[model samples]
Target: MKSKVIQKIKLTKDPISNFDLVIQAQKGVDAEMAFEISETLLMPDEDLSLILHLSTKTLKNYQKSEKSLNPIASEQVLKLNELRKKGEQVFGSVEAFNNWLKKPAIGLDDAIPYQFLQTSGGMDLVMEELDSIAYGDFS
Candidate 1:
């Protein structure tokens, strides 16, 4: 009889599966991953602080210590990654999506989408708006 060693592999592909995201969230998101997300999204520390509900001082400490974000923050980070993908798909490019985020949208009550990235409910509303645009229901 041969003994088999089963190794768990973390998913590193784009658009990670929901199950994998849940697991990753539970384990917490590392500083490197947070940095990657910020870089990819062109988000400044001030914006990130709002999303994570953490003070700028704490965020700096986390960076200095190479800490992992808590589960709630980790989950928010993962969701933001998904939102980035969806935004890119809808607008045809990251640049276009980012431009859209900066401008006020009529459907979003003339509010800039970037301002809504702070909370889960606001993120969902943005996602809904994206879906509406993608589906040609711009009204």
Candidate 2:
């Protein structure tokens, strides 16, 4: 039984990169993995729920389910993974990236970047800001 449990845990991929996980997430990753990915991204349950447009009870249900996320939810998770991965890469660490997300940014018109990850257009704006940061454009 223990070995079976271990094997079940091992069934999940150990992704080489966050983007790799994003690919998995887009294709309907297991619900448990969604929680794990949220942790990996340093996202609070509230943030994740907002990003997913899901209720807290829904998230709790997903946590308890043995099934994978539906296509819509999976795509949301993918978007989140993209943002978290890009943030970490750009800021060089999760700590710096999360800090930047919380702080107001001039590029975002003084809005917190992390809150924008809840939607695609907002995510695009945040991505553009990160791109500018990466290229030293800042404009």
Candidate 3:
């Protein structure tokens, strides 16, 4: 197994609004930014590739070349970042949120939330679950 060595880059000191993320997504997400998001969410290349509809080899190639992903993938990256923030808020910590992600959620038809992250629709469902949790609605 290849070890991941994350070299963190400064994203922004100020909070990024949804409008800013939309603009950034339109501009494209570069390899470094994607990697940063992966690190933030504790996701390995394999998982991120699945969510981005890319292969691990391609993700490595992009990292090697510092290539920027197209708009759609870029948007996915930003959405993941946003989800990470919301999850932390809902779960009280990133570690807790990550743990929750790996388990089956009754609200999601007993599917692991991590698996749901692979598609936009599934991501929306995961987000809704988080919202429900935040609002104290466990059912």
Candidate 4:
């Protein structure tokens, strides 16, 4: 039997299907991927750095060397991706979700959801609020 060359894949194309892609991620996200995520979220470099708990110099070093993120940072990236997917699901569009993120939400104590996206637990709370929105139980 001829040996088949299996190509490495991105694990999951959609966040809904593979919500724990971060846990499965071995190589983690690369610098290029990081940059793309930042662009997708419209996050400034400083904010990205804060969320990843990385210093500006460390980020610069990664970019300068074109390295993959550490597991912690990779996990954060996955969390962000999950939040993004959930946001789109709730708002019907990414643009709409982004706009909603900028506006204060009554469910979240009138805090902008975007401001709390810096951590996984915070994102989880945001997702919970989104759930409330979906169920028309905004309390």
Candidate 5:
């Protein structure tokens, strides 16, 4: 009789703010079998309205298609492709571009957040960060 291996793993990180909780998990029996998990435990009824509003907005965006995507978003996708091509020319592969695209758009909180005005700040911040990196100004 052969014995099977059982492995378990857990990971966790503190929330960015005192208002929330963050937890993560990973498990695997071998290199071939693995799983990951993440959890954000929100306070009971803590700004439930805001959470629902944000969720609804995200669902709407996720439902959007190439045809339904706003002009700006469509343009952004095109720009991303262009940048991807440039990266391929320099790096010899589009792996970097594909990796970037595969990332969840969570950092675009301002663009995705529900409020028209409040979200702009976040988007602006993200754009500024991108610009700084693009201009070779790491400071």
Candidate 6:
């Protein structure tokens, strides 16, 4: 029974957002897979930092929160709203917003750093695929 449970857990994918960050940070998931996943989860003009921060918060809550309806969920939602406000303040003008959008998806080497990629065995596969795509191996 224990082995069966473990196997089921192993087969399950980690939350899609974590996979996105691992690929983005490592520059290593397959382009198609990454693009598809990103498209599904992110709006075309979404701020990478905003999505990343939200994903990080969501993943943290999923792992640690008592349940979906816990106070932590509300707190995270509030924090995200606060972050959006800060983003607007920092990138007040349309030009600033455009420039920010044009910037590389992963600005800092540690923006969506390696430490966050250590979720499980599957992450390495995600990294490998991302690396290949970044190198134009897909074509």
Counted clashes in each candidate structure? 0, 0, 0, 0, 0, 6
TM-score for candidate 4, please give it: 0.77
Task: Summarize candidate 6's per-residue lDDT along 1-139 as a digit string, tens digits.
Answer: 4324323322334322444333333422222222223343232413322333435344444435422322322222222222223333444643443343334334233133223222333234334433443455431
True-structure RMSD for candidate 1 = 5.6
What are the lDDT scores of the predictions, listed in order?
Answer: 0.76, 0.69, 0.76, 0.71, 0.28, 0.32
Q: In candidate 1, what are the lDDT values of residues 1-117, reduced to their tens digit?
A: 000100122223356777977787887776556656777788998888889898778877887887878888888777787788888888888788888988999899999988999
lDDT of 5 by residue, 1-139 (tens): 0003111211212112212101111111121111111011111222221322333344244434211223333222222223333334433455543343334334443232212212334334434434544566432
Candidate 3: minimum summed lDDT over ten consecutive residues — where? 1-10
Reference-based lDDT, residue 39, model 2: 85
Residue 18, candidate 2: Cα error in Å is 14
C-alpha lDDT of residue 60 in model 2: 80
Scored by Cα lDDT, where does model 1 land? 0.76
lDDT, candidate 5, equals: 0.28
Worst 10 residues of 4 by lDDT: 1-10
In model 3, which regions exceed 4 Å deviation? 1-19
Clashing pairs in 2: none
Deviation in angstroms for 26 in model 4? 6.0
Residue lDDT tens for model 2, 1-139: 4324323432433313546445554556555656766887678888778877887678888778666676667766655656666777788886787788888898988888877888877877987898899888552
lDDT of 4 by residue, 79-127 (tens): 7776777778777887888888899999998899889978878988988
- Model 5: residues with Cα > 4 Å off, grouped in runs: 1-67, 96-139
lDDT of 2: 0.69
TM-score of each: 0.80, 0.74, 0.81, 0.77, 0.26, 0.26
Error of 4 at 37 (Å): 1.6
Taking every candidate in turn, the Cα RMSD to the unseen true structure, in Å, is 5.6, 5.4, 5.7, 5.0, 17.7, 16.6
TM-score of candidate 3 to 2 decimals: 0.81
